[model samples]
Every structure is written in structure tokens, then in C-alpha cells.
Target chain A: MKVTLIAGSNREQASSTQLTRYMARLLEEQGFEAEVFSLYEHQLPLYGPGEAYGHEEVLKLSQAVKSAQAVVLTTPEYHSSISGVLKNALDFLNSEYFEGKPVLSASSAGGTVGVSSLGTLQGIVRNLHGLNCPEWISIGSDQRKFTDEGEPADQATELRIRKAVDTFVHLIHRMYG
Target chain B: MKVTLIAGSNREQASSTQLTRYMARLLEEQGFEAEVFSLYEHQLPLYGPGEAYGHEEVLKLSQAVKSAQAVVLTTPEYHSSISGVLKNALDFLNSEYFEGKPVLSASSAGGTVGVSSLGTLQGIVRNLHGLNCPEWISIGSDQRKFTDEGEPADQATELRIRKAVDTFVHLIHRMYG
Candidate 1:
């Protein structure tokens, strides 16, 4: 199965994106193909509510979500909520793009716990009518920094991510396997 | 005192903008100069973190927020949260612009109640370190429509808005008087 992973940060060197890349490696090692969508690389215009400027990036983004059997989103908790870049990307997409798909959410939190933004992210999933896996990954502020290959250096953090990956993949099996 | 009002919607005919304009009238009638920041009229690029491409619109948006004695934000709840356009505009700003300023938030709701988004918006104000007035406004889907001159047709809705305006203006007086 193929999964579309969104690295939902706008910073040039975002730990959230790095975490997404790490998760991509974990998913790939499990024999699933993973595509990482980075906002820094694939920029989008500010969305007009009803107007479609027909931007190329938006088309690619929509196509990625449309074709994926499942989707993953990684974000950094900014000011107790999800980053605006991620929120904007979600704005450009419609319910049909994510409908019935198994979507997983993760966070590289700035604070002690990233649960603040997760609730809002789940709300976004419900808004898109996507089936969001209950188990989500949250790398606290101190645990977010990763190596060059996007591997977490801390063992416990790595274990949490691995278990999250397993839970998500198992859920995907029930839906699409 | 000057109050900066943000019409936090991008729709061509957004009632949130209308509500903002209406509040402007109310603020003006009570002897406060009001300016409304609108996404539909003055657009901004998607924000890139730590990058100062220095768009003229961003400068103006920053200046408006920086100079206001008080600020009011009117957002339409999209997906049970604030609109992406509003969030993007806010992303371009920092706490220095809004610190200690009086910020009152309101919503043009898609669903029955907009409290769902207000809590998050208050979180945003807190992030900016602004003194958000405890009273907020929410126009339900039914009462969101307004006249071209920015007047609400519903009497009870108008009264509620007027009361919110009074509460906000009262708070502003306590802060700046």
C-alpha cells in the first residue's frame, strides 16, 4: 500500500518535517511505499474560499491525497495549535480528497505535551470526513531533534514511534488490506 | 483610541467582513476610530517562516495591528475552527505587535454555535500576549447576512452585537483610559 505523508511545516529546517521523514523510513521498511509532501519544497498560494487559481502545486497536492490509500500528517505545535502552513494545506483540500482514507497525525511539540494540537488535528480529520487512527505520535520538544537520516536518537522515543506505526498499519489493514 | 478590526474571511461576500464593518460603525459611533483589515480586499502570500520577503501587504498588516489601541477579530468558523485565511494572516504577525493590546474575538459560524472556534482563538490571543476581552460575538449561519452598508437585519442579533461592542469598548476604556 502507498501512504502520503505530509511534512506540515514551513521552516527551512523543521524538526516536524524531519520527524515525518523518519516515519517515512519506518513505513517503507515495513514494505509500504511512502511519499513525503513538504510545504517548504511544494509551496501553495493562499487559498481563496471558492476560487481555484488552478495552481500546479495544489493540483499535485490534491492528486497525492486522492491516490493514497492512507495519509499521515506531521506538524509542530505552534502557539498551542497546528502550524498555519499545515492548516492552509488542509484548507486547499476538500472532503472528497480524504474521504474514507485512514489518516494518521503526529506532532513535534514545542511544549511538554503535544496533545493540544492533536485534538484540533483530529477535528480537521473529522472535518474532511477521514477516518483518523486513534493512536497518534507526539515527539515532545526535547525529543524532536533527529539524525541526518531522520532517525530518532533516543530509544524510548523511537519505540513510541514504532508502536504508533504498527497501530496505524494495523488499522490500515482493516480498511484497505 | 483607534481600534483595528480584522475581517478574517476571504469569501467575496463574507458575512464575517460585513460583521466587522458593522462593528466598525458601532465603534465609530461610540467615538473610536476603526480600521478593518480584510483578506478579500488586501491579500497576503502564504507565510514562510524566518523569511522576510517584505511584501507591502505584510508591512501594512503589521503596522495596523501594531498601532491599534485595541483590536477586534471576526472569523467564520470553518471546520469547527477559525478560517485558514485568518490563521495565515496571523501567522505573519508576532507578539510584539499585539502584546498588551485589547483584542476582542467574534465568529460568523457555519454551525449552530461558534464557541468551538472561540476557545482556539482565545488561545491565539494568549499566544500574542494580548488582553482579550472576555465577551465575544458569534453570528450563527441564520443571522450572518448583512446589508451593503454593513447593518444587521435581525434586531436581536443587532442588540447582541451592540452589547458585545459595549462590553469590548468598556474593557478598552479600562485598559487605555
Candidate 2:
């Protein structure tokens, strides 16, 4: 199955991006084709009505999401919710693109937990008609979760991520296998 | 007192912008200095961490909001909430710029009502430390609310907007008069 992992932060070297990469690796290890879609590479035009929606970047990102069998979304908390970059990217697409696809909601935060961001992502995914996994992965105190090489630093974080990814993979398989 | 009316849509001839301009006219009628800030004119870069914050447009917007005694925010409902263009523009600044400032939340929608968008905008303003007015203006079936000259079409919609603006102006006077 092809699963798309969206690193929802636009920041270079963001902890959220590191966590997304880790999830991608885990999916690959499980023998699934994982594509990491970095927000940095898809700098979308601000979505506004009557504005030209023919931007190549927006179309590329949309096509990727449309083609994926399932999706994994990772974001960093900003103002107690998902980052505006992620939300803005989502705004460019309609509910039809995400209809009935399983999505894994994951987040990393500077605080002890990223529950709020998880909830926000869940709400957004539901709004877009994507079925979000009940078991979400949130790496709190995120700065410590990743090492200098952009990999998960501790075994505990790795285990949590693996479990979450496994759950998502299983759900997708059950739904679309 | 100075009031900033933000036309939160990027469309060339959006009803949201028309309603924002209408509100600005009402404020002017009340002898308040009102400035209409159109998101189309701002054309802000997508906000992200570690991105250069020195963009002249961002700086100008920040200065305008910081200097205004009160702000009236208007948006078109996109996916049951504010437009991404408006939200991305907001991401360029921090809560400090809006601290203690009065804000009037307004919206125009294609449906029969825009209550959801009003609630969402209210929450966002509170998150940004802006004191939101309780009397919000939501123009539903928005296409019918405006004329060819980009003005409010009916006496009823005009009255509703005037009442909201009057309430906002009174609150600002009580706070900063």
C-alpha cells in the first residue's frame, strides 16, 4: 500500500519533521511504500476565493494526497493548535480529496504533551472527510525525542511511534486491503 | 479613535470585503477614523517558523494592527471556519500586537447563516488576546446583501451592520475615550 506522510511544519529541522521521517521509516520497514511529503517543498499560495488555483505546487501536493491509499499527518503545536502552514495547505484542497481515506494524526510539541494539537488535527481531518486513527502519536518535549541525525533518540519514543504506525497500517489494511 | 477593518478574503469582489468596507463606512459615520485593510493588498508570505519575518508587508500589517485602537475582522467561511488567507496573515504576528484591543468579528456566507464562522473567529481572537465584541455581524445569503456598487443592498443588513459597529465603537470609547 502507498501511505503518504505529511510533515506539516514549514520550519527547517523542525522536530515535527523528524518525527514524520521516523514514521516514514517505520512504514517502509513494514514493507509499505512510504512517501514523506514535506511542507517546505510545497510552499502553497495562500488559498483565497477567486485567486488562481492553478499553482503547480498546490496541484502537485493535491495529486499526491489524492493518490495515496492512506495518509499520516504530523504537525507542531502553534497557539495550542495546528500550525497555520498545515492548515493553509489543507485549505487548498476540498473534502473530496480526503473522502474515506484513513489518516494518522501525529504531533510534536515543546511542552510535556501535544494533545491539543492532536485534537485539532483530528478535527480538521474529520472536517475534510478523512477517517482519523483513534490512536495518535504525540511526542512531547519534542526537542529531546530526536537526535542530531534527525532520528528518534530514545527507544521509548521509537516504540510509541511504531505502535501508532502499526495501528494506522492495520486500520488501512482492514479498510482497503 | 482609530479602527482597522480587515477584509479577510483575497477574492477580487468578495462579499466579505464588501461587508468590511461597509463596516468601515459605518465607523466613519460614527466619527471614528476607519481604515480598510484588504488581504488581497497585503499578499503576505505563508507564515512559518525560521522564515524571514522582515518582510515589509508583514511589518506594515503588524504596525497597522498595533496602532489601531480597535479592529474589525471580517472573513468568508471556508470549510466551516475562517479563510486560510486570513489565518496565514494572522500567523505572521504574535498575541502581543492584539493584547487588550477590541475586535469585532464579522463574516459573510453563502448559507442561511454564518454562526459557525462567527464562533471560530471569536475563539481565534480570544486566543490572540483580543477582546472580542459579543455583538457579531454575520451576513448570510451574502450574495443578496450587496449591490453592484459593492455596498449593502438592503436596509435590514445595513441596520444590522450599523448596530454591530455602534456597539464596537461604544466599547472602544468606554475603554480608551
- Which candidate leads the pack in TM-score? 1
Chain B of candidate 1 vs. true chain B, TM = 0.95
Candidate 1 lDDT by residue in tens digits, A8-127: 898878988988988899899988999999999998888886555488999889888888989998898998889999999999887888766777889888776787787678668756
Question: Model 2: which docking level applies?
Answer: incorrect
lDDT agreement of model 2 with the native: 0.79
Instruction: Tell me which residue pairs clash in candidate 2.
Output: none
**In order, what fnat does every candidate score?**
0.00, 0.00
Q: What C-alpha lDDT, on a 0 to 100 scale, does residue B62 get in candidate 2?
A: 85
| TM-score (C-alpha) between model 2 and the true structure | 0.50
- Writing each residue's lDDT as its tens digit, candidate 1 over B20-94 gives 989999999999989999988888888886554388888889988888999998899988889988999999888
Model 2: residues with Cα > 4 Å off, grouped in runs = A1-177, B142-144
Chain B TM-score of every predicted model: 0.95, 0.94
Candidates, DockQ: 0.01, 0.01
